[model samples]
Structure formats: C-alpha cells, structure tokens
Target chain A: MDLVNQILNSFILFKAAFLILNLILIVFLLVVLQQVFAMSSVITDAFDSGIIRTVAIALLVISVSLFLTALVIL
Target chain B: MPDLFIAPLNKQEEPKQSDDLLMSKSSLPLTELPSNLHLFSSFVANPRGIHFQNQDSDEKVLLFIKRDLITNIVWVGISILFIFIPIIIAVASPFMGNFLNFLPGRHIFFYLLLYYLFVGTYVFVNFFTWYFNIALVTNKRIIDVDFSSLVYKNVAATKLSLVQDVSYDQVGIVRSIFDYGDILVQTAGTLDNFHFEAAPSPENAVHIIQDLIGKEARNGLS
Candidate 1:
C-alpha cells in the first residue's frame, strides 16, 4: 500500500508539472501577443504587420487551448 | 555670389571637402524600385510597404535594412533540433523501459504536444525579434528600430540635417563573406549618434546617407 501511494504521488507531480508549465507558457505568450500589437502599432509594415499580429494571436489561442486541455485531461 | 573679401597671401587657403560618393549610389533608387523585391530581403530600396510612427506625409523611405538572414541560422538550427526531440524520444522509449512508468503511457503524447507548442512559441518570439529589428533611411530622417524582446523596444531617430558624417566598416571573415556590416552616423548637437548594426551592404548605405546630408547642407536646411 505504501508503494502504491508513492507511485500515485509521483503521477500527481508529473501532472502538476505539466499544468504549471502550460500556465507559465500561456502567460509568456500573452506578453508576446501584447508586444506584437504594440510594436506593430509603432512601425507598421503594410505587407507584414497584419500577418505578424495574426500569427501572435494564433499562438496565444493555441496556448490557451493546450492549457485547458492539460487541466482537464492530464 | 563670389566672395569680394581678399584673403591674406600669408595665410594658406583652407582645402575644400572633396565631394566623392565613396560607394556607388547608381543602383540605389531615389524614386521607384523594382516591384518584385521581397519583403524579407535584408536590404530593400524604396520600400512602399514601410511606414513608421510620426512619419510625415511627404517623407519617402529611401532604404530599409535588417541584419542578414545568415545571422538567424543559429536559432533556426536550434528550433529544428527541438522539433525532432519528441520523435527521437518516442522511438527510444522502448529501450528506456519504465522511464515514464509513473505516468500513464497515453498521457505522454499530450505532454509531447505541449512541448512542441512551447517550442513553437520560442520560434515565434525569435521570428518577431528578427522581423522588427530594422533601420530605415528616409528622405528626411534616419530611423533605427530595435525590437530585442518583450521588455525592450528601442526606436531611435535623427534628422538628416543633423547627420555630420557617415561611415561603414566590414570586419571579420564572416562579415566580409556575408557582405553585411555596421553603418555609423555621426550627428551634431546634443542628439545621440545612430548605429545601424549588421546592416546589409553598409557601403551603399553610407553613400546614400552622404548624398542626403550633402543635399541638405547645400540647401542650407541644417
């Protein structure tokens, strides 16, 4: 029974690590998105600004989705 | 108007500046440029797609440059290595046996997915840094835009009239082979000088800037 409890505790740690990593990534990506928006506003490249912003937004969305999935399914 | 004032014969005549375009500006366009120029090129002339903050309506961007693409090879290579790590681990998993025994086997796939997503973020951030860190030579001013990271974004500018001298140097075998170097502009007064680092074709950049400063000085705009 003690061995089983130890194994279960390790599994909890593994899951917790994934959740914490994903949460940190989500925050970092939010900052990135904001930076993209602010920088694009400062120097607008008619051809590439929109595309860069879209890419940033896409990354943020993917990150949030992954975080939610990890919370529910990890 | 010719100077009516006579110079003393005892005093030596001051030598005038020899106007020379050290590097040929023949290829640089003052007006229209080829429409096919790629947006990602490290050097671009007459960039129609570029517009910056506080730019005058009449201002025309004469030149645009960024650090050479070769400079990004390190990050590109690392990102590629990161992309393949999950595959390598999955293939080696059987040999390691019980390495991930604490966690359910199927859940490992989700973790791998999360890892790749984080790697994607790394790539995105690096790309953004490269894309935005650039310098521009407009008809009226010089702008150096430096976007290093989320916490640091620097945009430095000085009027063409304030530019006193322009020079570029290509050192090191790599810089020579890649044909990109630093272009330094000395400005007068209290304004800070501009340094365009890893600017592609620094020679031509210097020539273009010299021409602008010369024109501005001739018109007594400074």
Candidate 2:
C-alpha cells in the first residue's frame, strides 16, 4: 500500500510539472504573439503620425493581462 | 475607278505623312525652331542623355532577402541552453535513483528527445521567418514586408517619386562589424520616416535610391 501511494504521488508530481511547463510555454507564446501583433500594427501604420506606438503599447498591455489571467487559472 | 473608291483613296492620301509636307513648306531656318522642335532637337543632339534616362528608368527595384541571422543565432543559443537541461537531468538522475526510473532511461532519452523537439521547432520558426520577411522595390514603389512572428505580418510601401531623401546610420560598433543598420527614407508628403532596421549595406541602398531619384529628376527636366 505504501509503495502504491508513493508511485501515485510521483505520477501526480510529474503531471503537475508538465502542466506548469505547458503554462510557461503558453505564456511565452502569448507574449511573442503580442509582440508580433504590435509589430504588424507598426508596419501598417508606418505612415501614421503617432498612433502606431500607442497601439503597440496597448497590445502589449492586453497580452500581459491575458497572460496573467491564464497563469491564475493554471 | 468608281467615284466612291477614288474619293476614299484621295482622303487617305491627304493625311499620309503630313509632317514631311509641312517641313517642306516651312522655309524657316532650322536654328529658329519652335520650342517643341527645340526640345526634340536637344533630345536628338544628346543621345547620352536619352540613354542615361533609359537606364535610370530601367533601374532594378531591389528587395532585401531576410536572412534572419539574429533570429537564427538566438534560436541556436536557446537550443544550446536547452541541451544543458538534459545534462542537468542526467546529473540528477543518479541522485534521484529509482524515483525517476519511470522516466525511461532515467531522463536521458527524455531530455535528448525534448532537446531535439525544441531545436526542431526553433529551426522551423526561424526558417519560416526568413522565408517571409522580404523587401520589394520597383520603378514606382518600395515595399517592406516584415514577418516578425508566425501569425503576424507587417507590410509597408512608399512611392519612389515621393521619396525625398534617404539616410543610413550605423551607429554602434556591433552594427558596423555586422554590416547592418537602419535606413531612414524621408518622404516629401509624410511626416513619419520609414525606418528599415538591420538592413545590410544600408549606404549602398541609399546610394541606389539617390541615383534613381537623380535620374527621375533629369528625365522630368528633359
């Protein structure tokens, strides 16, 4: 019985580690996506006066918020 | 011949090569030609100018092929770093002993497998980025297409005629060593500057644009 419990616990720990790693990867991917979107907007607004930077910052903020929410859920 | 057929032939012949007939009628000296004639005469007299204009207009629009060397280097570095993770796992495998026995090869195979997977993904992403971000130039316009990430792309272009000035700045020692820097193109009608960062041989690019502009100006004047 003790050996069974130990094996189950190890499995749980392994599952948790994988979950956490997946969460990290998701966050990294989201951050990268946010930057990419920002860069796209910047390129689109290459001729705009000052809206490009503002839009990029707003996107970054939104991505961070989304990442935090995902982290919390995870 | 029938009157209708004869009349049609006379009408066709009336306008045939009238310029020659007009020149024969005009007894004015060749030196006192009209302004339009003077322009044609100047063009004819300077075949070099015409050739230059032709070559200028034929100037090839060049687009910078995205090498993505920086991205590639970063990916390689990340892959190398990830290799260390497996090393750590291997080193700890002995300490962990039977606890990690279920990991198959005590994490050696797992680490190696994960490392390869990560490296493969990184290389794929880098290659895709390189394959997409391209610059396009034509006689009339210059375009910059930036594929910064997998899901996003940025494309911008400016008319060749609207480009007022082009400047290249390679400030840092690293940039100079790497032969890459920013190219700023100033447009006549736009307040914003089009900046191409990390472009190779930025000075040469600027010179190419300047030469094109110069040729266009000459053509316009002519």
Candidate 3:
C-alpha cells in the first residue's frame, strides 16, 4: 500500500510541474503575439495586406484557446 | 504590305526631363540616373520605393540594400539543430539504454511542443527584423532604417547637399571575400551621420553618393 501511495504522489508532482510549465509557455506566447502586433504597426510599410494581419491575429487567438482547453482537460 | 492592324511605334526620343515631374532637392527619377553608377549586388532599385505606403510621388529610390544574407546562415543552422534535438535524443536513447532514462517521459510531449513553438517564434521575429532593416539612397536624400529589436526602430534621413563626405571601410578577410562592407556618410549641421552597416559592395555606394554630392554642388542646388 505504501509503495502505491508513493507512486501516486510522484504522479501528482509531475502533473503539477506540467501545469507550471504550460503557464509559463502561455505567458511567452502572449508576449510574442504582442511583439508581432507592435512590429506590424511600427513598420507599416512592410506589411501591406490587412488580410495578413487578420490571419495572424486569428491564428494566435485560436491556438491560445485550444492550448488552454487541453490543459484544463488534463 | 505592312500589317494594317499594328499601330506605328513612336521613334521620337523621350525628353531628358518630363515637364510633369516635380523636382525636389531630394528626389531623382531613374531615367536621370548618374553616369557609370551601379548599385551594389545586394541592392534592387525600384522607381518608387517598396514598404512605403505613403511615399512621395516624386521620391525615386536610387539604391535599396540589406545586410548580406550570408550572415544569417549560422542562426538558421542553429535553429534547425534545435528543432531536431528531441528526435535525435529519442533515436540515440535505444543504443544507450537506461543511460538516457533521465530524459522526460512521453507525458512531456505537449510541453515540448509548446517550448519548440516559443523558440520558433523567437527565430522568426529576429529574422524579419534583420531582413526588413534597410539602407536607402534617393536622388534627394540618403536614408538609414534600423530595426534593432521588436520594441525599437530608428530612421534617419539627410538631403544630398548636406552629405559632406562619404567613405567605406572593409576591415576583415570575410568582408573582403564577401565584398560586403560599411559606408559612412558624414552629414553637415545638426543631422546625425548615417552608417550603412554590412552594406554589400560598399565602394559603389560611396561613389554613388559622391556623384550626387558633386552634381548637386555643380548645379548650385547645394
């Protein structure tokens, strides 16, 4: 019984570590998205298409949502 | 009989300067390019500048250049190695047995994916910043656009007449072999000096600017 409990506790710790890492990754992704938006605005001459900006925003939003949902299920 | 459907082509010589074109101290059209002037190999001249949404109608781009592409080869190689690191470790683990057991379990796959995505984002941001930062020479002005990082950018411009001196430096064997060097333009008055870093064929850039200065001075436009 003690051995089983020890194994379960280690599993819990591993799950917690995964959660913490996911949170950090989320924050970094947000920063990256912000940087992209800032760069596009500051260098307006480079990105000519409104559709490209829209697509970039959409992809970022969908990825963030999906990742969070998967983490919640886990 | 000559084909009646074909219209006669005009053999009349085009005027050196069009009456409709506006003349500014800083703008020069491509048709009026200086004698014996050739842009460095890296540069592509556009009659109207690219990446500019509201560029002046009269502003003609003389030379457009970016840093030598050879400089990015190392970073590209590093990025590729990083992307394949997990696969490499996995393939090697079988030969090494439990010696590689220290590696994270399969449960870490999702986390690893996210980590890789973050790294890929960083690489992409840096590459675009390097690619977009450009040095421009136009009939009327010399421009330097620098994008140092995601958060910071700087653009400096000075009139042709204000270019007091132009010089180039090729200090190392790599630069000499690549034919890529730096062009320094010393401006008069309060304007800051424009430094074209890692410019390809720095000699031509210097000559082009020098020619512009001489022409401007001789025309009494300076």
Candidate 4:
C-alpha cells in the first residue's frame, strides 16, 4: 500500500509539471499569435480594426481559459 | 479624317519596323505586353504613360514595378489556405460524416454554410488588402507601396543600380514544378536584403534585373 501511494504521488507531480509546461507553452503561443496578427494587419491593407480587436480579445480569452483549466485539473 | 493624321500615318512605317526589331531583340512575347506599355524617358516602359514623376525627378524612387508573381501567387496562396482550409473542412463535414460518424458538429450542413460565410468574408477582406499594398519594380528604382491596415500607408523606393547581387532559391518538388520561389537581392546599403518569396519565374526575373543593371552601368560609363 505504501509503494502504491508513492507511485500515485509521483504521477500527481508529473501531472502538475505537465500542466505547468502546457500553460507556459499556451501563453507563449498566444503571445506569438498576437504579434503575427498585428504584423498581418500591417502588411495587408484591408484589416478591419474592429475585427482585429475582437479576434485578439478572443485569442487572449481562450489562452487564459486554457491556462486556468490546466491549473485547475492539475 | 484630318491632314495631320494622314501625314503621321504615312511616317509611321519606319516606327513599325523599328518596334518589330526591338520586340524581337527583347524576346518578350507580344501578347504578354502590359496594357500601358509605352517607352518612358529612354528607359523603362510606362504602359499607361501616367507620368507620376519624371525620370530625372527624385520621386523616381517611388516608381517601382514588382514582378506580378509576388502579389498574385505567394500572398494569394497564404490567404486561401489559411482562411479557407478550416471552412472547407467544416462545410464538407456532413458529407464526410455520412461515411464516418465521429464528426464534430450535429448539423453538418448548417455548420458548413456558416463556415462558407466566414471564409467568404475572410477572403474578400484579404483580397483588397493585398491588392493595394504591392509595389512593382521599374528600371530605375524599386517601389514599396504599403497600405498598412486601412488608413496608414508608406510607399518608398530604392535604386536598382545599388543592387549588388541577385540570387534565387527554389526548394522542394512543389516549388520546382510551380516555378515559384525566393528572389534575394543584395544591395549596397544598410538594408539587410530584399527577399521576394515564392515569386514565379525567378530565373527570368533575375536575368531581367541583371540585364538592366548591365545596361545601366554601360550607360553610366558612357
């Protein structure tokens, strides 16, 4: 029973690490995507300011939600 | 109708022969001529003859004629694949689900229609954005016309004589077959390098620029 408990603890720690890593990756990707969208707006002449702002907000929300969910699950 | 017209028409025979010789020497197909093709200041042809500025003017830098390949294919390809792929999959899902049940949406046709709407809007926005943002190359200088976002734009140019080297790289089977690739122009300034990615007939572009450079250099020396 003690051995099983130790194994379970290790698995929990692994899951926590994985979750943190995933959250970090998600945050990084979100930042990069934000920059890309900004550059896209600069290069392309027809970027609707309203649409860009909305899409950016949506992306930010999605990233934050993903990070929070991962933290909660971990 | 007028004597002035008749006199000019009679004198036009010499020009026709000369034009034919020039066309043959240039090896350019007659059919592919730009609509506004006209000889501009003993240098490049300004097909439409819209003199935004004279060749002697400092504003000559703004007269760039970029190869059509850059704006037409590279930008178009990115816009299509990036904006259309998801919509295509979403629309086709109903038909796809008939063969397999593990699809995402419940009402496939509805999702498909919504996807089409989104994609159509996306493409429409991208098309005009790309169209106005390009600058073509002229004989004297490179033009950079950028309509950044909806409001702001920066159009600039650099001299072709300042261009030191021109190289092309076509990688992968798709690039080779499609004849679209990168054209790298090394210049004699602080600008790192001008790179046109996935431009068609890269070799021809390079040759044309090189020939222009050579001709300009000879003219300068003379």
- Second chain TM-score for model 2: 0.61
| TM-score to native of every candidate shown | 0.86, 0.53, 0.71, 0.43
Error of 1 at A26 (Å): 0.6
lDDT of 2 by residue, B1-222 (tens): 555544344444323321112222223221232222111121110012111111245543333323325535677787678667767776887888746566545333433443454454455456445544555444556666667556667667777777788887888887778666777888886445577766665655566566556555655675
List model 3 lDDT by residue over B40-138, tens digit each.
224544433144433467766666777876667777888888888878877887888856464345545655666576566556656666655778777
Worst 10 residues of 1 chain A by lDDT: A65-74
Q: What does the lDDT read for residue B31 in candidate 2?
A: 24
TM-score of chain B, per candidate? 0.82, 0.61, 0.73, 0.52
In candidate 2, residue B108 scores what lDDT?
Answer: 36
Which pairs clash in model 4? B36-B47, B36-B48, B37-B47, B64-B136, B64-B137, B65-B136, B65-B137, B65-B138, B66-B136, B66-B137
Q: Between candidates 1 and 2, which one is better according to lDDT?
A: 1
Q: List the residue pairs that clash in candidate 1.
A: none
Model 4 vs. true fold: TM:
0.43
Candidate with top DockQ is 1
Candidate 2 stretches greater than 4 Å from native: A12-74, B1-61, B65-72, B91-99, B106-112
Off by over 4 Å in 3: A1-66, B1-42, B47-49, B99-106
Q: List model 1 lDDT by residue over B1-222, tens digit each.
A: 988998777977545433232124464543333323354678877766778899999887878888888888899999999999878877887899947655686578778878888898988899889988989888789999888967898999989888999999899999999888999999998888888888887877787788878777876842
Q: Which is the winner by DockQ between candidate 2 and candidate 3?
A: 3
